[model samples]
Target: MSKTANAGGHEGSAPHLHRLVLFSDAVFAIAITLLAIEIHPPEHWTSIADLFGQMGHKLWAYAVSFAVIGVYWISHRRIFARLRTANGVLDVLNLVVLGLIGLLPLVTELLWEHGGAAAIVYLGLVTAIGFALAALWGYAAFAGELTGPVHRGEALFTLARVAIAPGLMCGLIFFALNHAWGLILLALALGAFIAGGRYMRRQAEQAVEIDQPEEASA
Candidate 1:
């Protein structure tokens, strides 16, 4: 994407892109609300006891998926925050990303009920969503569709980091005869957040280095 300012020297497409961002936000908010409906609180003591016994596993899976989608939304907001404008490609990409994300409830429910290979499949679906998101961010960064001085390195780092958990978890499903491997996947998801946060911090530090020469010269 051309970094040059428009002839009038203002960001060309803010109004349109800003609306897109808001719309995407609304959709995400709705989707997250929907995710909560899948929890199915235990109504009877027997059911409650049974659920509590299995709740640890189901809860962990739900939390993992919940946080996974939440993180993606957070990163996407940051990425789009840099946009100069939105284009047809970006709109389509956004739809695709949201479409994939919209599948989370079904996938989470499948994991909660079936609890073996289905759990792995759910993770695989999430991984696919992550891959699509990474693609979307890469497109925005390279296209200069971002609204600000976005750090491409930081963007790429975030994408790669977000992708690791679901990808690895999908692989672990084969040995997940029970929820054994699913727990492993949850641990990896936590690691992904820790690693991504650290990477983003490093990126921020490097961003400061760009102003060093100007500071020294002054």
Candidate 2:
């Protein structure tokens, strides 16, 4: 079945979604693996004490990077799950999003090695992905590529849900620019992101539920 309610007309569009999602999954897997390769064993290993002492930030950074990439992958999966039909534009847009995701490993390592402005770049890239995500949702809804019927209000709700990531990332970047404790602020920012995501997803779900007709709901 198509992910959207009214994607019947666009079923014949070029580039099957199967291929696109497969390619996207490959990219995501590679990026996640690269995150581990970025982390190296402590050099001149001696004992548990030396190992623990040497691999301080690297461990923390790897954990954080892993979490970050995982979040992106989950979001990407959800979006594609909703994809009813694929056309050239939709496939290209998805590829663009994948391209940005592919850069996360490199940027994550850079952020770990150099913290002054790399955080800004990293968050900025995430924000771009957020925008691209918003764009994808907007296009699918507007182009009638979604599986079910999507009203304008419901579409806006979907947009808001995906838009939360970049919006908060942008705010965090600004927070870091003016504040001395950028690192500490990141903890707060991440917490806020989690909270916001939960709230937005709930809102979108409610909207979709309300819009889905009783007969069509089944």
Candidate 3:
């Protein structure tokens, strides 16, 4: 009886998981679309050049927010790919992450309009999202809710993966205090995150292939 209960709890139901993933994908799509709407063209400009010049900062903010949301979506997809089951705790954490994502549009528009500490609020939203990711991932990983092909340490790597952006954001906040180049650091930190995540995923997949050489060969 204990063994049966254990199996039921660990595996849950795949259909439920599929529905959750579908819902998540739809929300992410909507969030990305909303981000683009943050960049509004001015109703009046002296010339086309003036219009483009005024748009420069808004365009930059839009680009940053767009990339940030896309990264989170990709990370979410990657995490779900190796998930074996979801528990109540995971569900709550997932909702918190999504809630933070939904706030990006507000923060994006506010920062483009307000500047100043608005930048920090934007980055702080990202940091909260990162911490949520870490908690959700840690629960799934330590609870043995990861799939079979996941390497022994890959989930731990994921914890590290989601943590990097927030850690770098702290540096961004420092730079903002010292030099006002925080936006530049934001771009750089995101670039490093995308590059590093790809590398880590590739390495993990290769390790899995090596471990299951017979299946790999077949």
Candidate 4:
């Protein structure tokens, strides 16, 4: 009887986690679709040059928003792949991340319509999303029986990967506050993100080396 109950519990928990992932995926899909829907072609363009010029802002906004949302989708997949189960708190945290993701299209529109002046608002939303994702990962990894054994180095690397770009972008955007300089800040943020990734990867490797000996003996 006890064995049957244990098997039933395990079966039930997996479906719960599966349902959560499916719902999150649907939200991501809708958000990306909304972004593309926001880009409408110019109604009256005489030449290729005129068409390109008119569509430039919309195209740029769509590209950036697509890339950002794509990254979060990948990160979300990675984080959930590491989990073994979910609790109420984990469910709430997942929703928080999804909720922030759902706002990207609106912010992308703001960027398209207002240019650099709207960047702070756009990047601020991104920053919030990044931090919320980090928090969700942290909670799942550390708060009870949600995730399996997470390596220390890997955890640090994951946090750095998910959090650093938006944080840097947000800080830089505050100073630039325009479309042209916003591109410059993005380049800077990418460079810094790469450097931070390398540093975190090295830390993770060292952690693995340190743990290997202890793990072998045990």
Each candidate's TM vs. the true structure?
0.72, 0.71, 0.75, 0.80
Q: State the lDDT of candidate 1 residue by residue for 1-218, as single tens digits.
A: 35432322334477767787888888788777777877766555476668788566667667767777787788678768766666666677889988988888788778778877586687678788878877777776765344455565676676686566555654554345456867777577668768877888788778879777878999
Misplaced by over 4 Å in model 2 are: 1-15, 166-218
lDDT of candidate 4 over 99-161, digit per residue (tens): 999999999999999987888898889989999999988777765446766666668768866
CA lDDT, every prediction?
A: 0.70, 0.70, 0.74, 0.80
Clashes of each: 7, 7, 0, 1
Q: How close to the true structure is residue 211 of candidate 2, measured as C-alpha lDDT?
A: 68
| Residue 85 Cα positional deviation in candidate 1, in Å, after optimal superposition | 2.0
What is the alpha-carbon lDDT of model 3 when measured against the actual structure?
Answer: 0.74
Top lDDT: which candidate number? 4
For residues 1-218, write the lDDT of model 3, one tens digit per residue: 22322354434557656877898888888888888876788988999899989997677677777777887787888788767666556677888888888898889888778876687798888878878878877766666454445555566667887866654655475466567677788787778867876777788888876878877778
Q: Name the weakest run of 10 consecutive residues (lDDT summed) in model 2.
A: 5-14
Candidate 2, 93-123: lDDT as tens digits: 7878888888888887887788656877877
Which 10-residue window in model 4 sums to the lowest lDDT?
1-10
Q: For residue 77, what is the lDDT in candidate 4? A: 97
